[model samples]
Target: MSLEDLYREVILDHYRSPRNKGHLDSPDFRAEGVNPLCGDEITIDLAFDGDQVSQVAISGQGCSISQSSASMMSEAIKGKTKGEIEDLTKRFRDMMSLDGEADIGLDPDRPGAVLGDLESLQGVRKYPVRIKCASLGWNVLLEALDGEPLT
Candidate 1:
């Protein structure tokens, strides 16, 4: 199997059986994000342990890219401190960004150098319009972290 095939399989696996695909009963933080252009929506609930994320749950409905990306985001953010999440978010956004400015040494040839399985979704960059679909969950994550209201 080729690398692309592996990425596809990873994405499919996450979409079919999303991680943390639910909601916390009393989360410390909660927020939602919507990509109106593609009708993708996501809600994230987070519980913090001191300065770190102790738990996360996500609820949403959308395309495979959106849901799977949410699953990956939940997994990545767990046990991450506020600063770590911020840096990871930047790297993830830079990875999905069209502009060539990944200051964190994220080379396209080595997309997984920072994000682990989340890198599998880098293919979404090929479809410019679908970028929002994949980023819906991440945006929601930011909102929750910032204590922003659901939208």
Candidate 2:
């Protein structure tokens, strides 16, 4: 299958069977995000240990991009330090900003440049409108770090 097709399958898989799709009873940080344009909403709950994310859970309702992005992001941030998560978040935003170029640092062969399954969503950049859908969860994650009240 083509790379794009593979990416589509990955996204679909995440959407159909999301990871960390639940709530944390007592989370250290929590934030919710909504994309009014598309009506996508997500809540992120994080538990941290001395500046490291020990666990992450996401609850939301939205399109495949938003849901799958939340699932993928939850998996990525778990067990990561605050600094690492911040860097990864920046990298992900940079990836979303790509305008059809292969500069998101994704290289299947190289492997090192790949952002795991998160890179699969790179195609979302092609649809400018969908960018917000993909970024909803990520933006909430940042807000949680900033101690903003989630609505």
lDDT of 2 by residue, 26-65 (tens): 8888988888877889998988877789889999899999
TM-score (C-alpha) between model 1 and the true structure: 0.86
Per-residue CA lDDT of candidate 1, range 1-151, in tens?
3547434988989989999989998789899888877778898999887888888999989888899999999999899998899888888888888446435565678757767898887777777777888878878888788884232
CA lDDT scores, all candidates in order: 0.83, 0.84
Least lDDT summed over 10 consecutive residues: which range in candidate 2?
Answer: 98-107
Best-fitting candidate, scored by lDDT: 2
TM-score of each: 0.86, 0.87
